[model samples]
Target chain A: MPPVLQIIDLKDSQATRSYLTKQTLRSWLLTTDHKRVGLLYLYTIIVFFAVAASAAAVMRLNLLTPRGDLVQAETYNKLFTMHGVLMVWFFLIPSIPSVLGNFLLPLMLGARDLAFPKLNLLSWYIFVFGGGIALYALLIGGVDTGWTFYTPYSSTYSNSHVALMAAGVFVAGFSSILTGLNFIVTTHKLRAPGLTWFRLRLFVWSLYATSVILVLATPVLAMTLTLMALERIWKVGVFDPALGGDPLLFQHLFWFYSHPAVYIMILPGMGVVSELIAAFSRKRVFGYTFVAFSSLAIALLGFLVWGHHMFVSSQSVFAGVIFSFLSFLVAIPSAIKVFNWTATLYRGSISLDTPMLYAIGFIGLFTIGGMTGLFLATLAVDVHVHDTYFVIAHFHYIMVGGMVMAFMGGLHFWWPKISGRMYPELLGKMTAIVTFLGFNLTFFPQFILGYLGMPRRYHAYPEQFQVYNVLSTAGASILGLGYVLPLCYLIWSCCYGKPAGNNPWGAKGFEWETTSPPPSENFEKPPVQTEEAYAYPVPSSEPITE
Target chain B: MNARAILYEQFSDLEQQRESSLAGIWAFIASEIMFFGGLFLAFTVYRLNYTQAFNEASQHLNLVLATLNTAVLLTSALTMALAAASNKMGWKYSTLLLLMVTTLLGALFLAIKGIEYIEDWHKGLFPGSAFAWTGSDPGHVQLFFVLYFLMTGFHALHLMIGMGLILVMLLLTWKGWINSRHFMPLDVTSIYWHFVDLVWIFLFPLLYLLGAKI
Candidate 1:
């Protein structure tokens, strides 16, 4: 009766098994399986994380003395630049979405895989190729321009590898775009029967929002960087002031992508925390619709406030005022997420498990980060502390304290599902706590030093700022330990830790309904989602069964 | 239809597979729009700042050749549409013929564009040190040519990619891989081709015709 006959190959999937069983390098290198691709991203980004963190470590240690002891001024500039570029593009942007989203999206949606599985694999290849090019730039001679790649200096004067690094980011930008495209199409066309928009998990909602931002915003960065690279190579007047070009134009175009890029960095972490909150608290998210729409709202409103970053760049006063107001408005959606997450936690079965501990850390630190963001959004206040350490401290809180916390928590929460083994629960909890303390120690003093007018991007500072810098350096060592422990034990758990069954935490989601590692086609049969996501506190009389 | 013949493992049925491909291509198109949108924004700002110089630069572009190329490209779109329609009707030979015709038309457009580029190069319309503009506001005029080359160069790159894809589709069609029962790849390729065509449609009026009368 249908126009075209449709057939379901039931027998083919009857033999479905673990995707990880194929243990050849070639299988992984050429595989289109989403789960394997997810692992590929996981392994790749971890390498990037270590490199970027090491750069941060060296910089923090160098800041310990007022005399800029560790590296030259030029070298320090390159260190921070490399740190920001590698971490933002290589690690944070791809962390949750590429690894966890690639793994869980299909499982949650009850689809076999993403809409374009080959595109997913291709994105990973492009990511690695681009990352290789970028790291190669660092190995040869590094670009001194910060990740912002502001013009005139970068376009006309900088002697370092600006064009090469821009080329790397440009290539990687396509990877981000493709990944976003895959997620958006998968969410749209691949949902299982009975899974409506409102019925999807909060994590999926957040990724969808993140994907929209990725799809729309990243290409502008690609084009902007292309122009920047071209200008550098050709010595054109595009961003060079000497040839009658305006530098502000570069800032405008850069922030247009970069500001939304800030959201691209954080929204998935918010998604992960939403899942952590619901799983730990044993309750439905209090305002599910509000939380869902707020993700979309953040993605949309993020575009309008890019001008906030251009406030002190000699933009018009009226434009600054508009950008300032728009920047404040983003807090509405962000606060909605924080408040809704907290409300979901209130009076519930609160367990301070490792994932939940990281989730709690996310809430506190993100609140601090978000609140400080308001201070920077205030026009006069920003003028006073524009490029100061306070600004550095503010973003580090959001990026490191907030997003990194959420990333760790999500990794812990999904560890059982991801690896089919439990990470040592006690060790996990301790790392989460240490990371929290170390993060505060590391960044909290910078807020004070910033308010005291010590600028960023400087290797040396006044003696009054030395005490805080020392504390921050001490904290960096501890934080490094916190990061390293999980890397060691998570690998150990994969081989030797007790085998975790499908639903370790009694987590309520379609992903939990399958085998621990999940089959190549995700589910044995297409799952029909009948209840809404986070249908928590199911009566104890009826147990959840695999 | 052989159930396993055309369907990918990830999809349950043919309809879902086709729908997914359609949705995926449209999403890619939306991204491409934003990609070009940035270049267009640059053009708008600079044109607003240096109107007379931009007008002077615009005059240097070979309008007759560009107009001929536009016609050639628009005809290629028509032939591309016919190829898709012929494949749908299961007319194998006409599909192949129309595809070849479309590819040729696209080649002709590129040829005209190449000729124009050569003409511009002879005139020293290139943006760097060899630029030979003696007009007032030479700096901004040089800026105009810089954008002119970047925008058109990027467009040509995309068009080349489109042609490569179509060539592959042509091969696939000859091998009976993209027949009526499984034409999603060809359909999506046409979508991309049209998107590139559509971008040129906008680029034509904005770049080549800006202040032509004034």
Candidate 2:
């Protein structure tokens, strides 16, 4: 006998469930089922979305007039800080990956469930427990550390709820780590027979890349936040410059996780877009190898360029120059991905459905987002424009405009399968159009505001910045409308939308090869892959299940 | 059916699963290395900046106690490995004993850690605005203590978790549930226990040896 015992002897969760389901509270609370766990994450993230969106609303109200008419500088500071904290930490990062990824990864991989399902649900509890403490912090008061939680300020200066929020973030880090662990183990051990690595749907590859980042990067963030909490509660001399600690060290620690974190946000959407582009365009993904490896390249190259955020933090000049260079290098694979995606659409049977519209919107916005990133990557320009609205515009272009678009596209695309119901395609397209228009209207003006030298995180602005701020605030209203529309229809669709046929889009992935609204167990028998992912020239007339 | 073929059929799946899991665990451990690796690099850089102070500070670290803890931790790791091995060999009694010993050693390690924290408290090495120390470089001496607390405290947390896991393993072993065939529990616990040991193996020398030139 070999010396090592197998580490994963997960009990059939149904046994645990049947026992728990006998007790109602235990059924819901003690449930270790991945699907139930996903629902918990979905519910919690929705709460986070509401909380963060409210902050955004307040921010827009304050910006209604250029100068601060509603909230004080301190209050304004808290709003923006909370907005960023809730969105990045609570919603955007975990939205698709944690909830949907947890739900789908095992199913798509043809497994019994994730390698560690209890860990999956435990991750959700950690997230919500963390969110509770953070919400309590907001209720009592708030932290002024900014979402970045920049040190010394977070440790010494801010009083609202730094410890509580940092503790929340610290706790949430475990969730990310567990999710990543579950995904990594699942992808490694759980594939159906004949489902090789290259045969993986691009979405699977995206989640795989995302899971890697989650495992590798999140622990650093956890430690950073732990150190911050210690400093706040105990007055530790770790980041406090009064005691000879370097504030710059904290920046290094925080950004190391947060930057790669942005990839965690986008990689899944990139996965979604890949499926979207392929299905709608009726093509095998052009340059499939390049596109897949490009995802991996982006995840890897992502770690090298975190220093770009610190150029103006007075890091060594040589370091700044090097970061600028490496930042440019990171863009190459991202550019290659975009090119490959656009190439996939060249002269195919293109369908401009709701999901496809969002995908196209993603291409345009992400291109702008990405190109502006290049502008920021140059030392000379970045030094001039660091912490300006240009930076704001640059990220919003990618984050809200690109990732959120792709997320919505994926949601619309998969809603049929997930709910066994199809949404009104017309309404989804209208929402897509309004979102794009509002998004551009909101952020496009901010680029000029940045160029004209308006700083971010300020409650009031000078007369010159007024016009842009007003336009931006107006755009937020429309953007808010766009967001609410989907919540309405998606919920409606769950109950009343028409029953979707299997292979509704005639897409060829293992996921769609299964039934719409797949059984409690994912498959009757493992799916056999006789062809490549997104295989073309398989007549559109043929069913995806064939 | 003969026991050998039954075992053979079971062994192949277990072996493949083990190889894949070990690869995954090693990958995870490498990331952990990079995680703590960043902190160690920071400690190195800061120590380089204040070698004399760091040297003086190292004298205050209880080397004998640290040495004792290291031995205890490494032994726990050995027990953890034995538990995994014996599980695979169908040595049920041996698996439970190894698990119990591993858990016991983990408790001893934490007890030593508590004593060390008490000693540091007596020495005024705890970090705070009011903290005071008599090392050559006050600034970096405090810096040294910051690292000391962070690294050791983080290590203690890991030990606590390893202890919890061993307890869980002991429970499963008690139920006569764990065995050679379905031993994922042993493997996972071993990975975690070894990780905690590996962290200390690095920490002991960093905190107690290098930079001690005073």
Put down candidate 1 lDDT per residue, B56-80, tens digits, no spaces.
8898888888888889899899989
Q: Once superposed on the true structure, which residue ranges of model 1 sit more than 4 Å away at CA?
A: A1-16, A538-546, B1-5
lDDT of 2 at A515: 56
Please write out the lDDT profile of model 2 over residues A19-122, one tens digit for every residue. 12243766777766665677678778888988998998898788777678999999988988888988998898888888777767866676656766666778
Docking band of candidate 2 = acceptable
lDDT tens per residue, model 2, B73-128: 88888888888998888787888888888888989999998998898888887767
**Clashing pairs in model 1, backbone N/Cα/C closer than 3 A:** A390-A450
* Interface C-alpha RMSD per candidate, 1 decimal: 0.7, 3.5
lDDT of 2 at A259: 91
Question: How big is the positional error of residue A26 in model 2, measured in Å on the Cα after superposition?
Answer: 5.6
Per-model lDDT: 0.90, 0.81
Candidate 1 lDDT over residue span A1-546, tens digit each: 122311333222322356777789999999999999999999999999999999999999899999988899999999999999999999999999999999999999999999889999999999999999999999998989998999988988888999899989999999999999999989988899999999999999999999999999999999999998888888778878788788899999999999999999999999999999999999889899999999999999999999888779999999999999999999999999999998988777888899999999999999999999999999999999999999999999999998999999999999888877899999999999999999999999999999999999998988988999999999999999999999999999988777677788888999998877777877867899999989986434555589
